[model samples]
Target: MTTRTDLLVVGAGPYAYAAAAYARDRGIDTHVVGIPMAFWRDQMPADMYLRSGPDWHLDANGEHTFEAFFEDRGLDPGEHDPISIGVFLDHTEWFAQRKGLAPDPRLVVDLTRPNGTFVATMADGDAIEADRVVAAPGVGYFAQRPDWHDQLPAARCTHTSDLVSFDDLAGARVAVIGGRQSAYEWAALLCDHGAERVDVVHRHDVPEFAKVSWTFVDEYVDQTLAHRGWWRHLPAEERAAIGRRFWEVGRLTLEHWLVPRLTPGVVHRHPGCAVTEAGSEGASIGLALTDGTGLEVDHVVLACGYRPDLARVPYLAGVLDRVAVTDGFPDLTEGFETTLDGLYVIGFAATRDFGPFYGFTKGCPSAARIVVDEMLR
Candidate 1:
């Protein structure tokens, strides 16, 4: 089957939905393809909590906010607090439906430019052609697979993004690497599910917590939300260094509530240690570390999180060869267009150009505004 449109919004995450809605509103013929919120629905644990506050969500043309969804459903909006994964997923689906968007749900296998337009082939052999292509990938495309993990068998090492359930891991000794939210959250979840023992191994001494005030968000929406806010006019290195600082405070932070649940001894911390070698050791895995410590655990969970490297995305592999990239991210214009004409990337795909904000829902509105606005011009 073949379908054609002026714009192809590829991905079902917040970024895709926002782009689709904005493009359609601007009178651009847009077709969205991909399962809506597939990452939040499939990759994330069912009981996990989003680090974003209630105010953050996949909004449609500035109309359908998560707060509005809560209000319409007669539920308390919980203004400044974090929301559960379930609620966020529901809101995403509602945003899709409300915008009259029903994604094709088929995975894009490859994308190519034969002439001026682009062709996106799906796994089911369906074809789509569009003058412009927007790749709004979710976090899984960037799941961190530590290089050292290659020494261990796949059965023993898994990233936190890949786990659907902790049921099979019950009573198994587990070690979760990284000091961020995923590390602490997964450690707590594992212990709660009765893992024999869970170790949180981190290169850092402690976890960072959310510290940005809501006022910061207000300023962001009204004025400071672009490429690096005040740092936008700065040199690339300056912008990126600022991004690194921002990341340490935001993405690397742990949810305060997780600390209490991660009781001592049950969720052990091995901070400032590095795992140098790991391999199958009978029923368990033997992990040799920089601190001269060795661990024998049934499983090693990598909560190291994701890096938005286009090369890591199988579907985008064909297109990546031509796109300009700096520091593992696409070199995008203000409109999110890649070096290749008419080809665009949003969400985390635009990180190197747009900064870290593009990866989160909070940036969706601005992303939507930029893409559609540029498309019309």
Candidate 2:
């Protein structure tokens, strides 16, 4: 059977929720597909804390905001300064409830434009037709595995997303590859779970564990709404400077809360190092580092982070050949419309043109407003 809608959003995360809510409120028939916040619910660590605060939310209208949820629940924002994953999940659910957004919990297996309209094939062999498709796929599919990753036994190594819970890792030594926030946070969680040892190896020096301001991104997001193609039109050097600043703050600095959990003896930091060789050693995974040292751990966790690659999205396979891309990111217009006439991409995939903030919840409202405006036009 087939159903029809004016717009179909291909993800049910924060981006999808915001877009669908805004479009529906504006009198557009919209349907959202995919499990809501599946990544956060099933992939992230159980005790993870978000880098963003309550100011970030999935509300395009700004009425059902996270701060507003706090007020409704009689909860103090100060008590959740560094919001826990559970609190964020609750807020997202509350916002969705208030907006009356119940996404269809089915996977879109294939997407194609056989005729003038787009048809999305659901996993259950059902189809849905829409005037336009907005893909807001998450970064879970774009994991950046190292070159030597395949050399190690598959069972012995896993990405940070795949190994969300560290409960069974007690008494087991681990090797965490990467020095970013996720890397450090995973190491701390392992320590907290009673891991025997965790060697965090990376090519850079230890990042500073301090608080930093993210208010600078607000102006850039505001600029995006004020001017069309604002980010892409910036001078090359200016863009580079902005990227460098983001890297310095977001990547080169770790959260202060992790310091207490990442004990020196339990979580060892090996800076200026990279994994030279990896293989199985008896029951453990053996890794040789560039620092002339080696580690024999029960498991290896890769925190190399994600990159944007449209081809990795399975459902987009049918339409990917027709979609224009550069450096793995879709070429999007100021309104997030792709080269395809009725297809759009938001979230991480739109970062290349819309700016890095689009990959986070803070840009959800702006992205929803821009895309819905284009749809109406």
- TM-score per prediction, in order, is 0.92, 0.98
CA lDDT scores, all candidates in order:
0.79, 0.92
Q: Lowest-lDDT window of 10 residues in candidate 1?
A: 222-231
Stretches of candidate 1 off by over 4 Å are 79-81, 208-221, 224-232, 236-241
Per-residue lDDT over 199-250 for candidate 1, one digit per residue giving the tens place of the 0 to 100 score? 8788878775544443344444445344423425557886777577666667
Give per-candidate clash totals. Answer: 1, 0
Over all chains combined, what TM-score does candidate 1 have?
A: 0.92
Query: Which candidate number maximizes lDDT?
Result: 2
TM-score of 2: 0.98
Measured with C-alpha atoms, the lDDT of residue 95 in candidate 2 is 83
Best by TM-score: 2
lDDT of 2 by residue, 1-377 (tens): 99999899999888999999999889998999999999989999879999998888877888999999999999998899789999999998998899888999999999999999999999999999999999999989898999999988887799998989898999999999999999999999998999999999999999999987788888998899899899999998998999998889999998999899997788888999999999996797888999789888999999999999999999999999889999999999888999999999999889989888887889999999999999899
Query: Candidate 2 clash total?
Result: 0
lDDT score, candidate 2: 0.92
